[model samples]
Target: MTVALWCILIAILLPYVCTWVAKISGGFRLKDNHDPRDFLDSLEGFGRRAHAAQLNSFEVIPAFAAAVIVAHLAGNAELVTINVLAVLFITSRLLYIICYLADWATLRSLVWFVGIGLIVSFFVVSV
Candidate 1:
């Protein structure tokens, strides 16, 4: 249960972390003339990657959240299974963020698949 809670916490904070990375990456300004799209477009390199990561983070949340909640509620999984998988998923997501920021494309994609795999496994256990 605690592991599930921690994973929930991670999910909640992940977006803010991504947003912070995007903002701090570089090339953003407070110019009045720029619209949202232009402001986004002005970002380059790290900022651009961070922005993409931010968007990607949003994309994964629904399925992951559903998997965790449904599986946990179904009560088929042992505590150890839940805890280990939660740790693995969270760790993969953390690494994915780092890899994205570092522009490690290959590693980023791999970790993303790991995260997805973890989520799907969660669902599988529930069913």
Candidate 2:
């Protein structure tokens, strides 16, 4: 129950976290007046980064929900583990978004894998 709630909280908050990352990454500008090329480049890179984060959430959130629910149903996966994993997933996602925007390809992918792996492992163990 607590794990499900925390997952839900993190899921809702993750996108905003990504947006904040983009802002910090210099993707956000105050003025509309700027070079088209710069804007295009920023948009492309930021778009991809944001999309990657979104895709990660899409991949993991449902699995997190399913795993927690299944664990509850099956009488396994203690609340502590589930909540801790959920926090870990959220942290990994934050790291992934920052790494993506920073163009740290290897680190980004690794963070993504960790997040997805956490969810997938939960799925396997829950079932």
Candidate 3:
């Protein structure tokens, strides 16, 4: 599989990693709550941001995955272009998470835009 495909796999796991961070942030042995909202409400600060990161990940994933699939179907993708965009998207997301945790609102917002732009680039490159 291409590194881009592996990045997609990693992307699938990233939100769960964020969720885990949120769960463990409180320094308590709290089991996963049956209601996700309740779980989110219980967190504060970094944990809250981590939960937001997980939520943000979910929000972008469908578009990102769809773009990749559509790109593949379009059959004109330059692998290098796709791979570079995919990596940039992943990097943006990771940085977004870090910025969120650190409460860097300006940086986090910029990274979020970068991620979205990268996802759009996936579609553009496929054309």
Candidate number with greatest lDDT: 3
Summarize candidate 3's per-residue lDDT along 38-125 as a digit string, tens digits: 8677889999989988998888888887777777678799887777887888898899989988999999999989888988888888
Please tell me which model should have the higher lDDT, number 1 or number 2.
1
Q: What stretches of model 3 exceed 4 Å from their correct place? A: 30-37
For each candidate, what is the lDDT? 0.80, 0.67, 0.83
Candidate 1, residue 11: how far the Cα is off, in Å: 1.4
Which pairs, if any, clash in model 3? none
Task: Count residue pairs with overlapping backbones in model 1.
Answer: 0
Q: Give a tens-digit lDDT track for model 1, residues 1-127.
A: 4687678778768967877777766644577235755665668889888878878888888887787788789898876787778788888888998999999999999999999999989877766
Q: Which stretches of candidate 2 lie over 4 Å from their true place?
A: 1-4, 19-42
Q: How far is candidate 1 from the true structure (C-alpha RMSD, Å)?
A: 2.3
Ordered list by TM-score, greatest first: 3, 1, 2
**What residue runs in model 1 are displaced by over 4 Å at the alpha carbon?**
27-38
TM-score pick, better of 2 and 3: 3
Error of 1 at 16 (Å): 1.4
> Of the candidates shown, which would achieve the greatest TM-score relative to the real structure?
3
Model 3, residue 112: C-alpha shift (Å): 0.4
